[model samples]
Target: MRLTRPMLALTGAVAVLALSACGAGGDDEAKAPETATGSLEQLAAKAKCDPNMQTDADEIRQAICTTGKDKYILATFATDRGQAEWLSGAKDYGGYYLVGRKWVAVGQEKTVTALQGKLGGTMEEGSEHMNPGGSHNKGGHHS
Candidate 1:
């Protein structure tokens, strides 16, 4: 068989279309999977810290756990909207952390890893002051 110019152009166009159709969007355009809420008790059970070390604030639910010599805060939102809000805000705050539909943990790398192992989620690392709202200062000041 002999090659022709039009055929090659058509083939290239088709290839590009096919690749675009099968492509995934960038992170900004990607939608996160809907996450179901787990009971606070379940979260506590998976945490290394005492179940009693928890906060039942209106906006957030959190548990404080200590593993080895590291203490970290494991948190979850009360509603799906809350979860989305927190995830969007926290995604940039680096360090060893895990974010799930119903849970998030922040702490030292090893401590976050141990809890993530028990809880099951993706772990990420980066800077620790990527607050979305610009409310918290690096020096622990909030305004």
Candidate 2:
């Protein structure tokens, strides 16, 4: 059968739609607060993520408090490829960290990557990141 112009356009549209669907990321429910500006325990509970709350850095110092303050987790990350060891002199929140929390902190580009991170919480470091959403990377890495 001969393909018509409309058929060709329909095929192209389907291909684009398929690609866009595959590129989608987690929705708002999956995201922790944009800023770790609430009770550390509360945010952790809401996000269901472990809190680190590093001490010593100015921002972390002012942001989180071990002696009963904001309660943000502090995290430091080291990368496998050496794209900056995710170190901040001090950071607040690591496990499912808020933006700018630690080494593998999530941003627009690293949304899924940060969600994948499972480091931080206790004083000790972690081996790799974990997904709090309990979703797996079945298709591939997040865009």
Candidate 3:
């Protein structure tokens, strides 16, 4: 059988379409599964907590949640920058933070770890602020 120009063009077009379709599907598969992001109440509900409203401000909405005697503060931010700034400042105090998309849950290490299992966030730790005299004090002052 002799090759023809029309048949070659059709074959090339079909190949292009098949490649394009494969590329599209590959992109979808390559991407990670989207994590759910929600408000303070919605997230607390997911984590099975009765959120006590702490601060309901324009920049952030915060709630104190107690899960089985483990207390934690869950906060959702209006802007990513605000959340980052808050986290930065809070880190100096030394605690465990379960961080998500524009949201953070502050608590003890064990509590935050447990929350992360339910909330799906990365664990962050603040500085322990230890003094040279084997003391975990803020200003390291012993009078």
- Per-prediction TM-score: 0.53, 0.22, 0.66
TM-score of 2: 0.22
In the predicted model 1, the residue pairs found to clash are 49-65, 94-127, 95-126
Q: Give residue 142's error in model 3 in angstroms.
A: 14
Error of 1 at 26 (Å): 35
RMSD of 1: 21.3
**Of the pair 2 and 3, which is ahead by TM-score?**
3
Q: Tens-digit lDDT track for model 2 on 1-143?
A: 44333432343233222322223244433333344333334534444555555323322221121212222222222222221223221111122223333322322213323333322221222212223222233445554
Cα-based lDDT for every prediction: 0.51, 0.30, 0.62
RMSD of 3: 24.1
In model 3, where do residues sit more than 4 Å from their true spots?
1-35, 130-143
State how far residue 33 of model 3 sits from its true place (Å): 9.9
lDDT computed for candidate 3: 0.62
Report lDDT (Cα) of residue 68, candidate 2: 22
Error of 3 at 65 (Å): 0.3
| Clash count, one per candidate | 3, 14, 0
Which stretches in model 1 have alpha-carbon errors above 4 Å? 1-37, 51-54, 126-143
- Model 1, residue 89: distance off in Å is 2.2
For residues 1-143, write the lDDT of model 1, one tens digit per residue.
33233432233233222322232211222233333237666765655456444456665666655444455666766666766555554444434456777676665554555555566666665433533223234467554
